[model samples]
Target: MKAILPGSAADTDKPVVLGEAAEPEPAADEAVVAVEAYSVNRGETFQLDGGLERRWAGWRPGKDVAGTVIRAAADGTGPAAGTRVVAHPPAYGWAERVAVPTASLAELPDSLDAVTAAALPLAGITALRLLRAAGPLAGRRVLLTGASGGVGHYLTELAAASGAEITAVTATAERGARLLPLGAVELITSVDEAQGPYDVVFESVGGASLPAALAQLASGGQLVWFGQASREPVALNFFDFFKGPNQARITHFDYTTSDTTYGQDLTALVRLVAAGRLHPEIGSVRDWSRTADIITDLRGRNIRGNAVLTVG
Candidate 1:
């Protein structure tokens, strides 16, 4: 099996290196999945760049994966061998195969091909969980920043289906076109251009966008901050919070919060895609070997949708 790991010398040209790894075997409650494709997240780049933390030697990267079951659970409790499945592996999913517990598996049907299934788990589940926390957004005005990314795109469609009025913010006109059909009532290239007084904001871009989003919230509105794509620390003053007539609610959401509901929400997302109600927008698809370039694009915010790396 092959996997991605941090390069031995951080000062070298490449921060990540690809090499052979030991194949994993299923534990009694786990199965070995043959990874067909996987998506990239900004968080992974941070780890690879040493921005988030120190990386140990030979530590694997990646989290979201879509593939087929090659080995069934030894306990006979998971999907049988050959079942198509998507999984949020216990880290190190950049490899060709991952040993995953049944609890983390979401069975994918033929209607949902592995290529698309591979792109949904992490972003889709995060979107579902964010909307779930917003609590009945129907008829409410919502602002979604970074609306072209994986989580943003999924959040736009999901929120629209729930009847919320959506104002989506992205970085390019071509990217803006990709969001409209998903039901964004208004699309802008920058958060400064969006008309708000929004009931909720799913904010991904940090720095000024955060304060800009905070300034637009309706009384008692909520802002959900998830990512700092802008690469700047969040800086807001008293006036930013007190400028509004009424108080606004701001909360941070990440994938780990829904530990118990991870599989269930992920399964629901798969079913939604299978039913054609939700679409996982894939921004880029490349052979797994090009992972280095893929990571570069992902870190530069060049990908318009979920970026997938296909395993041969």
Candidate 2:
């Protein structure tokens, strides 16, 4: 079996390699999936490029995968053999096959292709959960910072459907262009340009962006901080809160820590895609052999949305 793994720490350009791996062994509550396609996420690029340190020597770098069940769980808890599915494995998903827990697996409809299904797990689930955190979007003003990635694409469409007015912040107008049709009322390059008094703020690009978003928070608004793509420390003064409406709050988010089950949320997203209600923006699709190149593109921000790689 072959899987994409982190290369030598000194290798800056090629940070990952399609190397040999042990065949998957499913637990009683897990199924063996024959991976058809997998998507690379922005966070995985950090782990691969050494931007985020690996806690162990042999850490693997994949999370979102779509495939067919090759073996059902011994306990019969998940899809049977030959079922098409999208899954979020605990880890080690960048392989020909992976062992996925039943709780993280969702049967895919025949209408949904593997490439699109592969794009859904991590980013889609995160966006879904973020929207859940925002709660009751109808008639609310929502501000989304760093609104051009996979999560952003999903979040924009999801929030807009809930009747929330969205102001998306991107690094450039061209980078933010696609978000317009997805339901963003306006796009701004900097968070500082956002109109204040938003009911909910989805903040991902941290740094000065954090405080800038806080300044726009409305009375009792909720600002969810998810990622720090800027990789800079956020310095906040006590008076920064006074710039916004009183009692505004900021909540840090981690999708893994969310109460929702992966299978449950993934199924909701898959159903939307099947019904033409949700669209997964696939920026790059290529053979899995080019996985390293895709990772490089993601790190460079050259690839928009999710990047999917097909397995032979």
Best by lDDT: 2
Tens digits of per-residue lDDT for model 1 on 1-312? Answer: 788767744643576778888887667988899899888887877877777764455567878898988899989877999899999876778888998888888999888887798888788888888887788999999999888888888999999999999998888878868788999899888888878789998888898899988888989999988888888888889875887739797887876786465667778888899899998898889998888888888877788888998988
Evaluate residue 223 in candidate 2 and report its C-alpha lDDT on the 0 to 100 scale: 92
On the 0 to 100 scale, the lDDT of residue 308 in model 1 is 91
| Worst lDDT 10-window in candidate 1 | 6-15
- Please provide, for model 2 over 1-312, each residue's C-alpha lDDT reduced to its tens digit, 9 standing for 90 to 100: 988877875776777888899998788999999999999998887777667876676679789999999999999798899999999997799999999999998999889999999999999999999988888899999999989899999999999999999999998888778888999999999987887789999999889999889888888999999999887878888876776578999897889987779999999999999999998888999999998888778777787788999999
- The model with the greatest TM-score is 2
lDDT of 2 at 298: 79
- TM-scores, each model vs. reference: 0.94, 0.97
TM-score of 2: 0.97
Question: Per-model C-alpha lDDT, please?
Answer: 0.84, 0.90
Candidate 2: give the clashing pairs: none
Query: Cα deviation in Å at residue 157, candidate 2?
Result: 0.4
